[model samples]
Every structure is written in structure tokens, then in C-alpha cells.
Target: MEAAGCSYQFRIALLGDAGVGKTSLLRCYVTGAQGAAEPDPEPTVGVEFYSRALQLPAGLRVKLQLWDTAGQECFRCITRSFYRNMVGVLLVFDVTNRESFEHIQAWHQEVVSTQGPDKVVFLLVGHKCDLSTRCVSSQEAEELAASLGMGFMETSAKSNCNVDLAFNTVTSAIEQALQQGDI
Candidate 1:
């Protein structure tokens, strides 16, 4: 197949406050299944990498290196170093946790400052939409994205809602930027 020879590798980082479902999102997208049905996710101590091959809109095969980072305050230094290597970033926030959503700006700034303004494609994702009790209004999420110059979507890793779409959308944006020589 033509796609077999058209391989490209892109690195993507998942950033947000701890417990914002960054690892859950990565597990869902990479494995096509939701994570264990547990009340709390074990915190990621450092960085974890997952790989998946996706066919782009133009039949180009792209290998995505999805990096899930430790969102705890102590890991900031370690996690910040990985930002420069990322072509795109999924800045995830928990829909139920207002603080997580509010912290998206810090994540956005970290990625932009590390990757440079012109090279990074960012997607603002409000995660955990499956939990109705914690839902943050979509309007708020959209406004944050608009303010930060990023695309926005609400996703539920538990329900598999918009999980794939978020990743694919960011990848497509990155591909388009590359085609235009913008990144």
C-alpha cells in the first residue's frame, strides 16, 4: 500500500494538572478501550510513552508518540523538558474540576514557550465528560480555547466519547501545518 511507504513520526504531549485524565485518555486512544473502572487513577511518577500508527486524511501513515506526563508539581521540571520535542499537545482538563480547567493556561504557556509559537499545534480538551456530577459547561471550555488560540473539545475516556476525534483532530492540524511549511 502507498501508505506503507509514507510514514511520518510525530510526538505529542499530554499536559494538565494531576488527575485530569491524561493517562486515561492515552490508554483509551492507544488501546481502543477504557481504563480500569476505578475511583482513582494511580499517579504517573514520570513520563510514559505510547505508540500508535494512524492513517492521516491523505493516506499518509503517521506514527504518534503520545507522551503522558506526571502532572504533580514536583515533576514540572522533568515534564517541561519534554515539551520542546512535541509537535502538538493535548492540554487536558477535568470537566468536573474547575481548577484543572483553569490551569490550562499554564500548560499552554509551557508548551508554547518550549516548542516555540510557530511550531506547536494545541488542542484544549475537557476530559471526564462521563461524570455528570462534575460537568463544567462547554461554553467555559470553548472560551478558554478561544482565548488561548487553540481548538477545543470535551471528551470522556470512560465513554470513549470524542477521544479518538481529539487526537485525530490535533494530528490533522499538525499535518496541515507541516504541509503549509508552518511547522
Candidate 2:
């Protein structure tokens, strides 16, 4: 929604299994600093909110309301509630963990059932690309994203790889949807 003349805001959510580096990705994208991924990064308890104003390619200033949700089962109820308001979502998965990658479907389904599929734009983010033991191959991730009609990108929150691009990708999709009256 427009906050003032020539300025608009959209709500976006980051979802994935626990320890997928959602927080780290947000930190990297917002702060332009790496190492947000601590050795023992605290698991998100419920939901954390972040905001940043960005100038879109179309030359519009956009405010992004980023909601980082807890991935644990215990917080599912809490996190699910926040999905309805999100116009875009970054469905993240750890590249090093196969289970996290497999859980992408469930997370996407949750958001779809809660928010309605067509109202929200989805981007599949494969995090932890800096790790050498990558369990989820880019081909597999891209296939899954394609099956779900979403775009895919690999990012390393530790090294700040594609952090901005991931956010920008989803935001650009949101902008396109707005133009097409999809949201």
C-alpha cells in the first residue's frame, strides 16, 4: 500500500526448516555485512520482523516488511498467522541438509493453504551455498521451484551470496503482480 506519494509497501515472509539461515539472509540483505550466521545461531522462537526501503527497477521506492518465521513445529501456529498478510515469500532451504530441502513442499503448502496460492509470490532460496557438502543440488532445487511455479536462487548467508538478489527477485515479482492486479 502507498505510505505517501510515490512510495509503496509490501509484506514479505521468509520460511523454511529450522537453521536454514533465514535470519542470516535477512541480515546480509539489509546490512550488507556477512557472518550473520553464527556457529550456534539461536533458533527463531516465533516471528521476527524486519524492514527496509528499496528503489525498484521501475524507479519506485518500496518498503519491504520482512517477516522471519520460526521453523519448529511448536511455533507453526504462531507463524502460520503471519502468512495471510504477506504478498511475497522466500521459501528457503539449507543446501547442506536434504531434509530441509525436502521440507520446502510442506512449507509452501502451509503458506498456500493459509494465504491463498495466487495472492502471494513465491521464491525458492537455497541457502548455505558456501558449505562444501551440498546435499540439494541446484538442478533438484530448480526442478522443485519450477513444479511449484516459483523462481529459484542459491545464496550463502555467511558469504552474502545472492542475498540482495534473492530479496530483489521476490520484490520484483511482487511489483509485477501489482501491475497486473494479481495481489
Best by lDDT: 2
lDDT by residue (1-183, candidate 1, tens digit) is 232454788999999999999988999898888754635668998899888888887988888889999999999999988887689999999999998887889888877777788789999999988887776799988988998888999899888999999999999999999899988
- Displacement of residue 120 (Cα, Å) in model 1 is 0.5
Tens digits of per-residue lDDT, candidate 2, 28-58, equal 7877888744564588899998888888888
Work out candidate 1's RMSD over C-alphas.
Answer: 2.2
**Candidate 1 Cα lDDT to native:** 0.88
* lDDT minimum window of 10 residues, candidate 1: 1-10
Q: Per-prediction RMSD in angstroms?
A: 2.2, 2.2
| Minimal lDDT window, size 10, model 2 | 1-10
Best by TM-score: 2
